[model samples]
Target: MMRFAVLGSGSGGNAAVVECGGLRLMIDAGLSAKQLSARLQSVGIDPKSLDGILLTHEHGDHVRGLKVFLKQNPIPVYTTPATARVVRETGIDGGTWKFFEAGQAFTLGGISVETFAIQHDAVDPVGFVLGDQSRRLGFLSDAGFVTRSMTERLRGLAGLFVEANYDEGLLEADTKRPWSIKQRISSRHGHLSNTQVTELIREISHPALGRVVLGHLSSDCNTPDIILNRLRACLGELGHGHVGLHCAGQHEPSDWFDF
Candidate 1:
């Protein structure tokens, strides 16, 4: 069985674990090492047991804890050269780092991983499709728009983790944020809106897709109800209403999703 747990998600931080057979991979380490250890323990995962860490980008919210975590664990970190250089510039060190180009496929611990570039305000952002013979898992977040290649690669997955960052109306109505910040949030290199998530879900809907986990929600601009309602409507229209739906929270690890 292949299973995953979102350790945390949001603007504050993001991380997740994907496990199959005896291999365990941490998708990102965004929180402090202490906080990350506690979250992993909450899910009965030992931090010392992690096999590797795969980074998506160089944004602080996605890679803040990476150096600290690597210092303690000394595990291999896989990412693009651009992101690795950014990490090195941050003055944190101690890990075996491996570089991979976007759109390349590689194998780690018998599982196949395919990487694809994503549009984001970061150096060389990418998403992943991981598979182990029978089941496939697609993970994409921090992307401004869903590209044609992303949709094509994500089809026919057993599970998916995609970002539903905000509701456009809510974001636009929020008076707390400055216009510049608001513009950035709604920009082509920012985050995905709820409507965009719905379109992506509809595009990737298939009978074999068992579950969809939404993450990276904006605390002020989005709510679980708003995102879920929109996604539910789209899934119903696409005849995929039976698929399970889940939301990854910022404060705690989500329940394990098994495939």
Candidate 2:
């Protein structure tokens, strides 16, 4: 069995735990060490029990707690060489760092992980698909737009944790953020919009896709009801109403989902 939980997801911090049998890996370490530990414990997992940490990029929202977490746990950190270099430039050194190139597959214990390049402003950002022998989980967050290669790579997964960063209309109408920031959010190198996410879901839909979790929501411009309703409407039109849907929150961890 494969089980996973999003410790937290949003602009403040983002992290998730993916476990298969005795292997448990963390996807990011955005929260502080203390907060990460508390969240892990809430999910009945000891922080020290993780096999390793896989990074999606060097962005602070994805790696803020990495240095402190490594100081306490000292496990291997897997990421692209470019991201690793930037991470070191940020004064986060030490720990076992293993660099992997995009479009390659690596094995960690009983699980297999495949990395693919993603469109993001950060240095060499990527997405990951992890699986044991029987089940696969696709994770794609912080990407600006979905590509043909990404859709091909993510097809037919048992579970998917994808970004639904913001609603285009809501974001464009919001006056709190500056125009430049809004432009960046909607740019090719920025986060994926709700419509983009819906398009991705439609393109990647498969019979084996059992679960879909909307992640990395904008706390100010997006709401759970809007995202959920939009996704449901899209999937329903495509005859995928049977697929289980969940949303990852910014402040709290989501329930453990088993595949």
Tell me how many clashing residue pairs each candidate has: 0, 0
What TM-score does candidate 2 reach? 0.98
Q: Pick the candidate with the highest lDDT.
A: 2
For candidate 1, the lDDT comes to 0.91
Per-prediction TM-score, please? 0.98, 0.98
Q: Write the per-residue lDDT of candidate 2 for residues 1-259, one digit (tens) a residue.
A: 9988999999999999999857999999998888899999999999999999999998999999999899999999999899999998988887999989988899988899999999999989999999988889999989998889999999889999998999999998999999999999999999999899989999988778889998999988898899899888988998989888999998889999999
- In order, what lDDT does every prediction score? 0.91, 0.92
lDDT of 1 at 98: 93
- The Cα error of candidate 1 at residue 226, in Å, is 0.5
lDDT, model 2: 0.92
Off by over 4 Å in 2: none
Model 2 residue 2 CA deviation (Å) reads: 0.7
Residue pairs of candidate 1 with colliding backbone atoms: none
